[model samples]
Target: MRLSRFVSAASAFLLTAALALTGSGPAHAAGPVYVALGDSYAAGVGSGSYDDSRGGCYRSLRAYPRLWANAHTPSGFSFTACSGADTTDVIKRQLGPLNASTTLVSITAGGNDAGFVGVMTTCLLNSSSACLRRIDRARDYIENRLPARLDALYDAIGSRAPAARVVVVGYPHFYKLGTSCIGLGASKRRAINDAADLLDTVTAKRAADHGFAFGDVRGTFAGHEICAGPAWLHNLTLPVYESYHPTASGQSGGYLPVFTAAV
Candidate 1:
């Protein structure tokens, strides 16, 4: 038997009332509407080829946003998400274009909030112990600063698309460490997991405070994490991907379930 998954559900009332400014019912209109907001992860980097003409942010049709769009067919989607956005970027640039007609909004952010990519690169290639030592110093920042930033983001989304059900996503582990995909040690892997958990906890708490849902991709990605069972990532040993990120199948196979549950 397939194991059942736990999906946290929130009331449509909470979202609808929040966005009452947008009007209501069939009078409102038809179709599934969505506005995506976030960084490279949300933009589909490393999964497939992005539009080079659109910059290095390689958004693929298979990206979760597109998958989500397809799943919600007959609906319109406005993808304002960018590849390198931090919390501030989401608030300033991504949120404005969104409107009350939007029924769903999915976002993954805050990794860039602390230069997360740089930390990951350093840890994956350098002395894992030392790299984590540097990252640990910012644990408090993740715990505290990140929550405030997310709260600000939530507030901004409400101001624009009050009725949209917001789903904030967490980052996944990039490397598995110790198993030697890239020679990272077990301790470093734990550090990365810890970092991801910190973000998840904060995102979940803030989402609850604002009556939205938080998509916990971390749990879904377990076992298959970095250098372990299936390694959801590539580029650790490659000239292919300089930055550690998820593989295409991983994005759909592991990630989609989590998102589907939330929806």
Candidate 2:
């Protein structure tokens, strides 16, 4: 019995010494509980491959949220981002899954609220002046009303998931200026891009105020804007809803990397 006790003590001591030398231990943190929220970009609108089970939300299997969940194999993941979700929709619908247990959250909204889709549509079918006017209206709304809505949404998210590391992702530039694009005139494209910049700036500021990390995908999507050779954003497609949104490659190459880095 004495010999056995002495051998066990020596073995434990050697194990401790080895652990100290190797800088290793047996402690393991639980996996993240990730919940994805926001608008069409978060739902992967242009990425295609939508799940029929999700109904009209157009939640795509290739969206960054799913990509992150697949890569990390998180403890839990709830993808509640809808296609046409605005700040109001999120406050009413999307906050259900978030809780204190959630470790990570991602959302990309404000674009729809700012009416960028309408601005793009106006730029497409109407005169350059008309498009500019529409963009101006959108900018007015974004600057004035959208801020309060965002603050409310961010505050609600915080209330629901206080412990979560919220990553508020912003949109990318839709077009590359100074390029000879056949669709819209150069001036129209420039105005649209400028509006996008304004929207991103506003969203980033609100996110910062909420102590949330803003995953700006603009850098990753720099060279991939429309008319930048092979674009990641769709110009116009058969499914009109997919227009002005990111392609599958955009979700994978553009959004996934930024989101992963943010997380």
Candidate 3:
């Protein structure tokens, strides 16, 4: 009876151990699923060559989301960031079918609403001071509309994926400091950067209120701001065409820390 009981106890212990091992898997056994949402910034408009099939939004496979995906091997990612997307665009198009299984979510929107692209295009047409005025006007529009729109977007995302950790990424400051442009003065670039900062602040606040993370990239681009660093953010260059957006290298560096830290 003793021999039989000893064998049975050992068998039960082995079975329990096996179950525990199988149930408590690795932390990243099934890699996290990330869904990236937003406008041009998130879409990597000027970073790398975009996939033509995905539309003219210029989403590149080498974009930040892809970089994060590669670093975190086996990570599942859905890059649905489109160009010219507004707050409403994210709520209606990006959040559909998202769920608790989604691990991370990031957005870079609101610039389109301020008509930033149009203002930049106009800058090329005339004197820099005139362009600066447009930027100021755009800033006012952003201060008025961006905050409310971002809050609504966050609320909508929360409704869809309550368990997922959302992250709203802020825009980086563009233009060099203490450096005047050949045609445009330093004041013009400074104003544009200032406007970008304001937009970022609004987006960050909205993310915080919604229990989501905010990736602050404003100060990060300080020294490397447009025309400041040897080669970072593009400014009046090919592919970039304007100093407003980030270069591919800048995007990788800017995105790496945030993506790694949040995930």
Q: lDDT for every model?
A: 0.74, 0.92, 0.76
- Please give the clash total of every predicted structure, in order: 7, 0, 0
User: Between the candidate structures 2 and 3, which one is better when assessed by lDDT?
Assistant: 2
TM-score of 3: 0.86
Report how far off residue 93 is in candidate 1 (Å).
1.8
Task: Give me candidate 2's TM-score against the actual structure.
Answer: 0.91
Off by over 4 Å in 2: 1-25
lDDT of 3 by residue, 240-263 (tens): 533456667767888657656765
Candidate 3 ranges with C-alpha deviation above 4 Å: 1-29, 240-243
* Candidate number with greatest TM-score: 2
lDDT of 2: 0.92
Question: What's each prediction's TM-score?
Answer: 0.81, 0.91, 0.86
Clashing residue pairs, backbone N/CA/C < 3 A, model 2: none
- Deviation from native of the Cα of residue 221 in model 3, angstroms: 2.0
lDDT of 1 by residue, 177-210 (tens): 5566555677877787777777777778888899
